[model samples]
Target: MCAAGLAWEPLLRLCLSASLVGCQNSKSFEPPS
Candidate 1:
């Protein structure tokens, strides 16, 4: 459990950052849809 949590934490942070960056990119640059 301890090792799993440690591994999960970084993955979670990476996913969160990716989501945040995607949001920012969408806001900053409009894509043709």
Candidate 2:
């Protein structure tokens, strides 16, 4: 369980970072009203 938690933690962080970056890119690319 400890080893699994360690492995999953970094993956979860990477996924969160990726989603955050994607959200920032989409917001930046959106056209102004």
Candidate 3:
């Protein structure tokens, strides 16, 4: 169904964005030297 697909698109995008932010946060951290 096109309507369901459209609704899921936003949810998928939000999930992707959240994961990307999490990835960036992890990547930005560093261990003590």
The candidate maximizing TM-score is 2
Off by over 4 Å in 1: 31-33
The C-alpha local distance difference test score for the whole of candidate 1 amounts to 0.94
CA lDDT of every candidate: 0.94, 0.97, 0.91
lDDT of 2 by residue, 1-33 (tens): 999988998999999999999999999999998
Error of 3 at 19 (Å): 0.4
RMSD of each: 2.9, 1.3, 1.9
TM-score quality measure for candidate 3:
0.66
> Can you write out model 3's per-residue Cα lDDT over 1-33, one digit (the tens) per residue?
999988998999999999999998887895656
What is the TM-score of each predicted model, taking all chains together? 0.69, 0.79, 0.66
Task: Write candidate 1's Cα lDDT for 1-33 as tens digits.
Answer: 999988998999999999999999988899667
Of 1 and 3, the candidate ranking higher by TM-score: 1
Two-way TM-score contest, 2 vs 3, winner: 2
The stretch of ten residues in a row with the least summed lDDT in candidate 1 is 24-33
Q: After superposition, how far is residue 20 of candidate 2 from its true place, in Å?
A: 0.3
Q: Model 2 Cα displacement at 19 (Å)?
A: 0.2
- Flag clash pairs in model 3: none
